[model samples]
Target: MTDKKQPRTPGAELPDHPKFLWDSPEPKRSYDVVIVGGGGHGLATAHYLVKNHGITNVAVVERGWLAGGNMARNTTIIRSNYLWDESAGIYEHALKLWEGLEDDLEYPILFSQRGVLNLAHTLQDVRDSRRRVEANKLNGVDAEWVDAATVKEICPLVNISADIRYPVLGATYQPRAGIAKHDYVAWGFARKAAEAGVHLIQDTEVTGFLTDGDRVTGIRTNRGDIAAGRVALAAAGHTSVLTDSLGIRVPIQSHPLQALVSELLEPVHPTVVMSNAVHVYVSQAHKGELVMGAGVDSYNGYGQRGAFHIIERQMAAAVELFPVFARAHLLRTWAGIVDVTPDASPIVGVTPYENLFLNCGWGTGGFKATPGLGEAYAHTVATGEPHPLIAPFSLDRFVTGRLVDEHGAAAVAH
Candidate 1:
């Protein structure tokens, strides 16, 4: 098949869109708030900073194209069914924003709350699921426990029969948990942020931080060093690398997380099915491809490609969970770096450096918490104080021995 290349100029008209963000690659000389990494978090931070705080003097510096990071590389899963109250507060806030993100952004994000079912195979898994479900309800997060029959009914493709190994005994069902189009989210935020006069500088890499004593004054970029009153690092997987450049260390380990899609088929999955015991989660996109993935690679590395055995194990679990998918052919596979913390929870909030904020350590659950974390992190950078919703997620928590443990809840059991 011969492919036709679309031509473009330095300042040419972008392909059809209601509004454009990055018309040119020019980076602003200075800004009040410089957000590094123009993915979902960075773009959303710019949008909220302008919309809520009226901070239009902001710039989002991206090393590559917009949303081309983990934002586009994720499985597009969105949920807030975490175990701890801290995790719930941050992620549930994101879910709330996700509920009305379409209207808020004035774009169709394809936010589908088709429910997410986490299957419990072992007794320990059942107990944890029940505890989490109850905790979710108590915390005002919608969740419940459903039997295997209900799981089968909710997701007809799931094989809940006891005849199978690691049979589904029950599931923690989050009715509002679902998926969204990840690319549209980044574009919507970028467009809105641009409309508010926030600059979206693409292909601009932040090489180092310009600091005054302990305070971060601006960023040193390949294009040119730009001054800023405050700098918010929303680089996700690359957060450590950026912070390390400034000799600011945090307990964040980067890992490679992989995901793939199956060939287009008739919709077999109506909702998300996550099996914790088996270590696989599957969701059918509107295009009929079964989007699925599992845990991160065991080793710590910056490489975006995960070990092949990870996907191999996930495929076994996929076939075991839904025999119908045994014949389904896998399509393309890709990976993105995830920054995992010691507790399997994120580290967000202010850093030791004055006027420099940190929003990393999201690990595998970052996509679901983008909107909420963006708003909270923006608030942190806006008012120079941590947002109450995310105050517990501060980096100080690690040193203070107040870790919010969510290893089972936040990992890629989806």
Candidate 2:
């Protein structure tokens, strides 16, 4: 916070007044809590752990640089319009957090609330969209069903005519839904957590767990063994690896989710448009580049890439939707491994292993949930109890037969 009494100008501010990251010297050998990943959720978990619970003696150990994983890789669309009450509750909470995240972090997260349009192509699609919109409203999440003409008004580039294959019959529009800068979200939390005395050790891989009986005491990292009173796994797709090492299994299959961007051009698309029928989603970044992607690769792999035919199909769908982009030069393409769960919901709660908490199974919806996920995870880690916001997503839900399946309302392909 700046002092009103102090004389300060925009360009004449004092030197070293703001630091983005804490130049952490070294691993302190032990910490009160150790977060196993340095992605958005992991860093935010540490931030809330300090800010809310006053648990400052924390360590966020990453195998690579912070947010180099799915945090930086996914399309940054944010929305909470879901079909289920449980899904709507958690995602709506995240939306509320996103509404104030920039001010809360003292940083510009570049969150643009242009809107999001989920296009409907078939009768079933229209039905599902209407049902979801009603459910979203019932759950107090803002959403509405808009006809094809309204869809055209929202995103003029979308081909909503009946002549096209999988023609748009209607759409579910959420006015508050939009995109943000992914890296800024991660770094914002990182800066805040670091400033709060959370140790962020990058390039440190966790080789194994240091356990006593069923309780995990610490972790055995490539850097060395570091002791911790408790540990939480926020390691996105890599959750499988960690659980496999612990000899327990979570029903998560990792798949490569890919996205591409076109060369910078004049702004045309004002809102995010998603077509589940065609399996393609598109949005224009603040810089005017067309940020686009379709569905995941059919095969399961951690290769962090897409099959040639899959991307080719995605491009075909994109061009079909936006014929104006047919000549747009491709700038870049990238991918990240998404951990798909049996129920398509996240698992964020206590595990069978004592003193070890699990936070994974978000699949393609993880990036949109950075803040609320972190808050719930921090509360769980601090109190050794699942926060109400995340209690329904426990691993036990798979066996208990309660699933927050939201295939109609989530992911990179929307």
Candidate 3:
């Protein structure tokens, strides 16, 4: 899967017959799989279905252009140093996949293993950080505890105070974690899936599902109806709406998470830094822009845009940590809607519906887990059984009161 060189600004208008979608008005035939949402998860699922499971009759339907959802809107941070074994293990595999995404997809995703440092500012924060490091190690992840001096050595720009509102203590470092090119990741999956004969239907929204009793027979899209043996709801923010159309209630809330990028400058920040006390995280992009992100919206909403207060607070935190950023100009800011669940982890695998699969509730961590989630989800769709990597993320957990909570470490933006 060699990545072909594309134009700098890629989206050109297609011909009367788009190469991305099916040419016919509406196919009277049925597909083996119909995946909703053309984001990372959806495209990745399509690729795995064809490449791994040998299922080629698949179509990915998106309301907007491909990868135009949270996949294009994320900060592109990839990490696996979570506070639980299940999360750490799954995401660690995701990180490994990212390491070779460029070669595997033959696409230049520009993955950089610059490392991630989760800082501690209070006693409780230090305790939690240690616990997370231990948990990550227990899960076979290389997470290490580093002191304030080591943090300074890694990122000299950080303002480590011994006596402040919340004094800086130490940090947990994960060298395997880093960042990747977000748009390239989306495009990589799209191109590979398209090459593998999966229909990438953009601007085709799934209005409702065609269900026979408890089983989903197909999907009803704005363009036309397409029958499918299995339907995967990879729609992140709109999961609730689609599930509700099928009379299924998902315990997920859509919230807006804001991120801003500063004007490109000489690269200074090397490692991803997250502060639990301030609920903020900052990293420098490959283009030298400082990307900063914070917690979700104060109130839940379907709106992707966020208030100015979130940016203001994030800027304050950035300047507090590294005063040099005070002089840096903010080039642009954007927000994405995250489908948050009670435990801040994703919900993957089968739902109450017989042939309907779910891969939503990613919150803010979906971008990193794109490959692994898609691979595992494709297995679930092909065999009608949850993969071992994603068995813990089933929808039944909410019903059985057995949630895989990662709130202690995931409270801050990843």
Deviation of model 3 at 185, angstroms: 0.5
Best by lDDT: 2
Query: On lDDT, who's better, 1 or 2?
Result: 2
In candidate 2, which residue ranges exceed 4 Å CA deviation?
1-20, 410-414
User: Lowest summed lDDT over 10 consecutive residues: which window, candidate 3?
Assistant: 1-10
lDDT of 1 by residue, 1-414 (tens): 112112121233323565454454477778999999988999999999988899999989989888998998998888888888988888898998888888899876767788889889989988989999989888898899999999888888888888888978999998888888788788888888888888888888989999899999999999889999999998887888888888888889988888888998775578888876788899887667888898888888878775668889989989999998999999888888888888888787888899999988888888888899889988999999999998988888877899888888766643
TM-score of 1: 0.94
Model 2 per-residue lDDT tens digits across residues 1-414:
111121111133222435545665599888999999999999989989998999999999999998998888898989899788888888889988888898899976777788889888899988888999998889988899999998888788888767988888989998888888787788789888888888999999998899999999999999999999999998988887888989978899888889888898776788888988788899888677888887777678888765677778889999988888899998888898888887788888999999899998888888888898999899999999999989999999889898888766654353
Mark the regions of model 1 whose C-alpha exceeds 4 Å error after superposition: 1-21
Clashing pairs in 1: none
RMSD of each: 6.6, 4.9, 4.6
Report model 3's TM-score to 2 decimal places. Answer: 0.93
Positional deviation of residue 313's Cα in model 3 after best superposition, in angstroms = 0.7
lDDT of each: 0.84, 0.85, 0.83
Better of 2 and 3 by TM-score: 2
Q: Candidate 1 overall Cα lDDT vs. reference?
A: 0.84
